[model samples]
Target: QCQGGYDEGAGGLLVSFYHLVKLAALSDRCTAGVMPPGEAPEEVRIKVFLERDGDLTIPTLYGLFRGADWQERETFDMYGIQFAGHPHPKRLLMPEDWKGFPMRKDYVQPDFYEMQDAY
Candidate 1:
C-alpha cells in the first residue's frame, strides 16, 4: 500500500513524497483489527527532489507497484513531474493539450477566454 504520493513546491525545488507499506508483514492481522505486540508493518518513506529549471524526472515505481500508474500520471499532470519509463505517461486529470502544470507553485492560471478552444 502507498499513501501521500504527491508532489509539492518546496522553496526552489519540486519534491515528491511517497509512503509505502509491505502488506504481507501485517496482512495476517489486518482483518482482526488488532496488532499483537512487536508486530509492525514494514514501511518506507521516499522523497524525490528535482530542480525547478532542470529535468523533473524520477524512476517509475509502476513496475513494482502496479497501482501507481494513475498516481504517477496525476503527479505528472499536476506538478509536471515526469516518471521515467512509465508505460503511459499521459495526463490523468487534465486535457492532453493543457498548458502548464496546474499544481506548481509558480503556475499562473490562464484566462478562460484563452482556453476556450483547447478542449
Candidate 2:
C-alpha cells in the first residue's frame, strides 16, 4: 500500500495479513495494505501509509477504539481495516451508539468542535 499522502492509485486490491507481514519483514521502508474485519465482505480496502513514529498514520483512516482492547482489536479498531472473513466487527472503544468515524480528515466534529480550531 502507498503512504497516506502518496496516491499511487491501487485500483482496489484485497491484501491479506500474511502478505503484509511478509512485506514488513522483508522491507525496511514502510508499506500499506487493506485489512477487513467481520462477516461483511462489502468493505473496501483503502491503502494505508505506515509512519516511523510507531503509529500507522492512515491519512484517510480515522476512529477511536479503547487502548485496553488494542491487542485484541488493533487491526480493526485503530486502522478501520476490516478483516473480510473474521467474526465480530463491533465497536472496540466508545459506546455502541457512537456516530461517525472521528479520526477521518473529513470527519466533522459536531457543535462545539470546529474544523478551523483544530489547527
Candidate 3:
C-alpha cells in the first residue's frame, strides 16, 4: 500500500523506480523517492542508513525494470547510493575515478578542485 507502508507478511519497504531526483538527508540518514508505475503512478520512498563515511547500498531493479539501469546509475553517480546488483553500476555523470559522493550533506569538498569537482 505504501513504500514503507504495512503489508501483511511483507517485511521491509518496497522500492519504487523513480523519475524524480528527490534525494535528501536526515540527521544521520538519507532518503529518496521514485514513482512506481502501474495502472497509475504511485510514489515510493526509501530511507537508507548511512554506513561508515556515509556509504549506502540499495537493491538494484535492473533485472525488473529497464529504466532502472540509468536512473540507479545516475543516483549512484550523484548521491553515491550504490545500486547493488546493477549490471553496469557505473557513474552516469561524474568521472570514473572521482572520489567521494558529491550529493552527500557531509561530503567533504576535496581541496584538489582543480583536478576533479562536481561543482
Clashing residue pairs in candidate 2 are 1-32, 35-81, 35-82, 36-82, 36-83, 36-84, 37-82, 37-83, 62-103
lDDT of all predictions, in order shown? 0.78, 0.35, 0.54
Ranking by lDDT: 1, 3, 2
Q: Mind giving the per-residue lDDT tens digits that candidate 2 earns over 1-119?
A: 21112212222222213111234433434234333332222223344444322443222222222321333244444334443333455667644555554544434566753334333
Runs with alpha carbons beyond 4 Å of true place in candidate 1: 3-11, 28-33, 37-39, 113-119
Off by over 4 Å in 2: 1-80, 112-119
Question: Which candidate tops TM-score?
Answer: 1
Model 3 vs. true fold: TM: 0.52
Cα error of candidate 1 at position 51, Å: 0.6
Top model number, lDDT: 1
What clash pairs does model 1 have? none
Per-residue lDDT tens digits of candidate 1, residues 9-109? 54577877778888777777576777887778888988887887899888988999888888888888888888899999999988788899888778888
